[model samples]
Target: MVEIISIYNYVMRRILLIQGLIGLSLYDEIGQGYLNEIDLECYITDIIPTLAQVSNHLHPSFERFYVCTVVKKVFFFLDHLHTRRIRIKDIVSSGLLSQLLELRDSAKSRDLVVNETGNWFSMPAVLEVYENYLDLDRDHDGMLSKKELSQYGSGSLSPIFLDRAFEVCRTYNGEMDYKTFLDFYFAMEYRKTLSAMHYIFRILDINQQGYLTAQTLRYFFDGIEEGIKAVKTVK
Candidate 1:
């Protein structure tokens, strides 16, 4: 039964890819067969109104923010290397475009759509992520300083972890852009993915080496211990 289910899902995914390609073909119309950031932004903006019809969770006032957040997510995942553009093939293969298209179906309940926390294109999920970013940007600077980001998620992440994130991940001066923050968020939230693991490993590999050594592990472990002690002291 498991094998059958796997095969069925494979077929359905292929069909979804084909459907996504047909729907998105016009966006890559110059025969470039890809979408640069501006092209993708326009495409997503055009579809937002249709998506809004079924997205009772999204507010009219927040549609612009929602669109910007979703576009950033697509680039973060599908472009993977921050390339500023993506091939339609990659978009279709990632199934994100298909997932966005699926939201157009009025048949899907608002509860079901909003609860798909793992789906990047989910309206409620994107809004939640955007809100979190806004809350963290206390300075209204549109970017997160180390002090601002340290307050993320109960403030429990080790100082060393954040230090390495700023060191290894792309940042503007000493602050992290929303896109880079999304990368950090994804690494922490979906640690099982290869990309996420690689990101985490990069931060942990303090010497810029390709692999983690026992010394590296010990260094972070010590940082974690100190963080725990500090948290306990506060209580």
Candidate 2:
């Protein structure tokens, strides 16, 4: 089942590479336009100088932002390859992998120099949370319940939303694993673009009934209202 889902995702991503993600309709034209207009090699050359300039000047947050921007932009180039049905893992295995690996290490070293902060990187933070999950998995079921995941509301998310979200968004056995947790996190927290809101719906749609009941929406909005009030009242 897991392998089937993984392959489905892989194929969908590849199809999306060529067809554009229907969920993110705006990006469809943008991606197409990018393919038509951008000379990727030239863009890479332009960014080389910009990256060198970014390193010479730094504030911690700004440095992180700049580095992340560069990383995101570079990763965007992967879409071109994706459009060609090339898997990034294969690319990672190629001669380019060492360079890409070093590139990230250099970025990480620079980021560390800027901020000696703990667990600033995403993967490490996720791993850290994974350890926390293991500790909190009281039943040893390898699944986290609402009681266990309540702590997810510590910052950015509302406890109410988390509670209701579990009821709505559960993909399997009315429970959540690390992967599903990440999906919920990204969908609600980052909420990066308009289309990402589908994730929210997945969380809000109770009963797999294909539409949200007013009661469900009201349940979610109650969380939003509570979240707003809490934020406003925070000391």
User: lDDT of each structure?
Assistant: 0.78, 0.48
Which ranges of candidate 2 are over 4 A from the true structure? 1-141, 155-164, 167-174, 207-216, 222-235
Note the clash tally of each candidate. 0, 0
In candidate 2, which residue pairs clash?
none
Candidate 2 local lDDT, 1-235, one digit each (tens): 9999999977855654333222223322445433221233333333333333233343444433333333332333343222422233433333232332233334554454433324223333333444555776678897877767765545556676676677665446777875455445444444654424555655567666779899988877788788788889995
Worst 10 residues of 2 by lDDT: 19-28
Candidate 1, residue 35: lDDT: 90
Residue-level lDDT for 111 in candidate 1: 50
Evaluate model 2: give its lDDT. Answer: 0.48
Which tens-of-lDDT digit does each residue in 1-235 have in candidate 1? 9999999988977786686687677777687788987788878877776663335566767766767777776776676555678888888777688778777756564356445666567776876787788999999999999999999987878999899889988899899988778778877777887767777887898998788889999999999999999989999
- Which 10-residue span in candidate 1 carries the lowest summed lDDT? 107-116
Off by over 4 Å in 1: 1-19, 29-32, 52-61, 81-85, 107-119
Q: Show pairs that collide, candidate 1.
A: none
